[model samples]
Target: MTSTAPAAGAATSGATSTGTSTATSSSLSTTINPTFRAPTPRHSSFTLSTISLCGQPEDVLDLQRGSYALWRDRVEMKLAIYQVLDHVISDVANPADPEWLSLDFIIKGWIYDLITPELRTAVSSPGATARTIWVAIETLFRNNGLARAMMLSDEFRNTKQLENPLSVYIGKLKAISDEHRDLGYPLETHALLLQLVCGLHERHETIGKYIQTEAATLDLLRLRGGQALHG
Candidate 1:
């Protein structure tokens, strides 16, 4: 009768087969060892290139020449920066990205530096200075419809004053507006004047209300044959 039990050689072969399976499993365990864990969430630093101020020379010369083209160029540059920042905010995943927001604030500060002194003189002297020409530029900013366009951008919507560098310039704008009112200027300049006031004070409802009240005094002058028709 043939024995069902394995012989000595067969038993030895079975033990070797079991030992080989254990070695293969141990090799896989070594090969699959963890290298590094996942990174934790943290703030990342970023950088942005500065915006160019094109057409500045032409605008400066035109200012001296009393040419509308110079004023137009200046207004265009201001609006262009505003528009570009607005687009950047929309394209980026994070609306509050610090680098992008800082660049926007820098551009705005440059514009304020370029215009505030001129604005101050114009508000003080009414119709008797180069600052009066600046009023036309301000009108271009508003009438071109870029101001409202900026307000529509995610940058404007998501912007927080505490995190924004532009907050300082905005405060400067409010100070300028307050100073203008104390200078006794009439409301005919309100459209341009209030546009600036509103641009800077948009975050403060009280300042906006004050601008509205101050702007209410503007009266249109009638012209007859290039001569003032209304007193």
Candidate 2:
């Protein structure tokens, strides 16, 4: 009976030890593995919208040397490509729209970069919107007096071939003619062709003479000749 009692007590002790070991493991697991999860970071404040517009337009708006018409067309085309033409054309602004206003300022910076220093000062005003600056530029160029037209005409008549290519010389004349035409004095087509023929380099004498002789029916394509000569 005494041996049997010791065996029974030994069995109870073993069972109690096993139960205590299981309880300790379960308590450690619960304490190590928590149910609460931390939040993920959003980074909303650090985020910024970006645009891909870089570099100045080829035709910078300098009235003394650059073509306004060409500059205006190029600027508009670039803005159209990036889908931001509305910023320069539309006067309406929604102050609540942060994205729209952000793009507007970006475009304004682009224009400021692409114009001449003289023009920059002329168009710049305190608190001017992009549209306002655009309109001011248009007014400055398109609303000058008769003296501007006269000066342009003089420049047109005196534009010589110099060391430039035939196409480049013609392009210069055409730009002047375009500005002149804008000011209500369109150069006659024949006169423009004559000016083009007269401004050719001495090396192109043969083609120049041919063009002069055929001036009556001279197609514009004749000026856009062999790539070698045009270049």
Candidate 3:
């Protein structure tokens, strides 16, 4: 489904409507761009209501030109916040008439905090949709290729599960694995299993070593280990 990417030209961005849903009319443009509409379902947020900004405004993602990894790291952190708040990057637009409330809140939080006035010219405008800004940021920073994926995979391989919380370690591992998947170089199931098993302490290894139920996926082994740890 079409999403609200950054505008190609100077005109108000055309919307990609879902059903009859439409974008909130922009204050900057008196003439409505009928082509513009809300984005596809944005999977985003925390407990929705309880998502207070605990971190500083500077912690938000930036549009300024920067290193790809650094920019992506910030974006990941921001997306992690959105995920916690129950926003899944699907589409932030409401299924009904697209309320700019969510988009406005995002832009307002981002406007003065992370972006320069020059950068803000694009996103803080009354015309910018959340998804538009979101995609724009990705376009600005999404560096992907064979070399990057290989580097990410190597990082994944080196990321041993030290003494850190199992859940946290697993989350990081899964996140890296997901990046690999998105980049079209996903780890094979067996390769992922080996990486996972490599992280477990000797104690947790026993759970998987003894499990005889058909063939357990690596995820299940991790789950079993978690249960054993908490037990």
Each model's lDDT comes to: 0.42, 0.74, 0.53
Answer with 2 or 3, whichever has the higher TM-score: 2
Instruction: Write the number of the candidate with greater lDDT, choosing between 2 and 3.
Output: 2
TM-score of each: 0.22, 0.67, 0.42
lDDT of 1 by residue, 15-127 (tens): 89889989988877777868745555322222223434444554332222233333445555555544443322233333377654455444444444455455434333432
Taking all chains together, the TM-score of candidate 3 against the true structure is: 0.42
Ranking by TM-score: 2, 3, 1
Model 3 lDDT per residue over 1-231, tens place: 765454442233333442224433443243566676675565332234344443564454443322334444565476564542223244655534444355445544542355555555544446555555556555534443466676777788798777876676667677677766655676776666566677766666674354333135336345535763344
The runs of at least 3 residues in candidate 2 whose Cα sits more than 4 Å from the true structure, single-residue gaps closed, are: 1-58, 219-221, 226-231
Task: Tell me which of candidates 1 and 3 scores higher on lDDT.
Answer: 3
Clashing pairs in 1: 187-218
Give the range of the ten consecutive residues with the poorest summed lDDT in model 3.
Answer: 10-19
**Residue 188's C-alpha lDDT in candidate 1?**
35
Give the least accurate 10-residue stretch of model 1, judged by summed lDDT.
220-229
Which predicted model would earn the best TM-score? 2
Estimate, for each residue in 7-71, the C-alpha lDDT of model 2 and write its tens digit: 89999999999999999989887778788456654222113135433365455677565556767
Better of 1 and 2 by TM-score: 2
